[model samples]
Target: MSAPLSRPSYAAVLRVPRARSTFAAALVGRLAYGVVSLSLLLATVRATGSYAVAGTVMALFGASTVLLLPLRASLVDRYGPRRALAPMAVLYAALLSVLAAVTWRPGTPAVVLGAVTALTGACAPPLGPTMRMVWGELVHDRRLLQRAYSLDGVAEELLYVSGPVFVGVLIRFASPSAGLLLSAALIAAGTCAFVASPVVGGLRGSSGRRQQGKSPARQRGLLQPVLVAAGAGLTLSAVDLLVTAFAERHGYGGDTVAWMLAALSAGSAVGGLLNGAIDWRTPARVRLPWQAAGLGLTVCAAGLAPGPWTLTAALACAGAFVAPALTTAYLIADETAAPGARTRAGAWINTAVNAGSSCGAVTAGLLLSHASLGVCFAAAGGAALVSAAGAVVGARGTAVAAVEAEPVPEAALEAESGRSGA
Candidate 1:
């Protein structure tokens, strides 16, 4: 077993052999994920001259991307990222390029465009899950993995922030189609480079082999992490619309909305870094509910702010909980994955967060129609409380023992990696 360090620096994570190159390539490919939605949404809206048409196309696209992620992830676990990711990235890029050309001028048929968008979304490579899986391989020491994931979560938040800014720049100078084409180029080039890395290149497929009888990922332990993740997603997604509504209600300008959202992102980034810097003795399963509840409470508190600046402050506090909750959940998911199921395990968390976000939009819309802003905030926070309570119940109610009660040794994790490869 690897000895636990007092505290592993985030710099130490990057120092792991081959980690920097693999991580950089993965980020380049994943940035395309961050960029595509806004780029495509704007392009579709411009092409159809109708928000309704664009909305439908985007809905289809998002649904395909989130719902089929597990299937895509399973392929990565089975065949390894080198083989699985490159082909998906190429096909996905090809579709996006087609979309850019089709949406260049107005009056494209909605159904035709929707078909292409859905196909494009379906082909999205599970880069985030695959990258996390690679992190598991690169760092066997638990402390280093914790630092690595925290660093990853923080970087991902920054990527989403930067992706929108990149799209905005394109819109300022060129067309939205330029962002789409840029997304295409990034994914194709980045994925090719990612696969060529020595770490990824060494992996092999043993999909049919039963090296492990049944993965713990298939057991009951995944429920808590997945549920908490979904709850976190729900509250976070609701904030976007809720803040906009608050701004409109107060007669604040659109920039107020942007500032509050940015505040929230800033908070998350700081929180993620802080979370990574610590070396906690508590198990992740023990810590998850507290983190979930913190997010819930802070968000509810944001609803009580009397002015825009106060609201920004409250949202920033809420944001602080976001990254820690997600990083903890991913840690649990990684621990649970076992053998040839790493990618799919991470994908489950991804799916829950996204599906919850989709639901959250509709939820906020309904609340805004019938309830006061305070009520909407309370209800969103209340959802997290329920999920936090449910995770505890779910863990105890199931027959399987709590997998997180004890740490799995590094040697066993190594065996898991060997089983996943040839």
Candidate 2:
């Protein structure tokens, strides 16, 4: 039998300057997102006095983000992130101030709050995708790109997991409004620094080509993958909501939710590291199913947890699959996208994630009001299973295509031939 294929080494991918700059930008943006996200969730609950209402507010917020993500991505691609980031940051801060002002009136109509929330969501810059694209452009070697993506994924997990705990502590001692205000300040400062960075400035002058013609129908078609990705995101979000609700029902309290979520983030960080380290010769189709299976199993096991600690463990296990899923989806989008559609593809994925999370939250709230938390967990678990099945199918197709593709470099072909001849 031929010798087993060896994976690409990380050493092959480590270019210094670009990697450092990408990491710095990603860290700054993630920190800003983390602060804002945690503050928003806590403040909404404090202001509304109902988890259901808070979920709704968050749903509206996500809806706005989903709607605006493509537009934002396009702008980033055209004008570059530096030019687009500043105004978005300013608008986001201003909108948060409005949200902080209106939040005190408790009796203020939900409709008004929702509108404001939507505006806040809309103003959120597509920082994650923009940064990812920057990494893709900046990193010349494929192996390095893999490492950069892995790093990006880790940063995301840290942001989400840590941000909430920090905000929760602040809200416990100070006030939720204070947390929100602080979030705004962080966003402003981070975005400003990111914009001012020389790396970003250099990118500004590179290109202004619109990816596609200004046809609405064509744009919609191009966005179909994003829509599918969004569906997946919504399902995952629902699972998260269910997990949180279930934890609370078991007398875990609000703080437990933070810990459980953190577990998931930790798992994701591990997954990202693994994804970066493994130079799989197998096509994505072979890998995607395993990733999805891990995610599904983790969700299902979470329902079997005996207590908060067990639940946290299960969620953390589930989180291990999160980054791989995200990475696979991004890779698929990159491979499948038409010329000039990269930004849109990235934006769509972000939109799907936010949209999915929003839907999940709403669904969890409804289920919590009527059914036992166990039912919600089971439902979420089932959804994850379904996602796994879909991923498997997609992976098979991708693998077949890869197998039929043209051969690689002469060295690679020779290596394969040599192994076979041996």
Q: Best candidate per lDDT, number?
A: 1
> Which residue runs of candidate 2 sit more than 4 Å off their true CA positions?
1-15, 41-56, 102-112, 172-174, 204-235, 248-258, 305-311, 364-378, 392-422
Per-residue alpha-carbon lDDT of candidate 2 for residues 325-382, written as tens digits (9 for 90 to 100): 7776666555555545566677777777776666666777787788766667776666
Top candidate by TM-score: 1
Give TM-scores for every candidate, taking all chains together and pairing residue i with residue i: 0.92, 0.77
Candidate 1's clash total is: 0
Q: Give the whole-model CA lDDT for all candidates, comma-separated.
A: 0.87, 0.68
What tens digits encode model 1's per-residue C-alpha lDDT throughout 288-398? 888889988988898899999999999999999999999999998888777688888899999999998998889999999999999899888877887889877765653
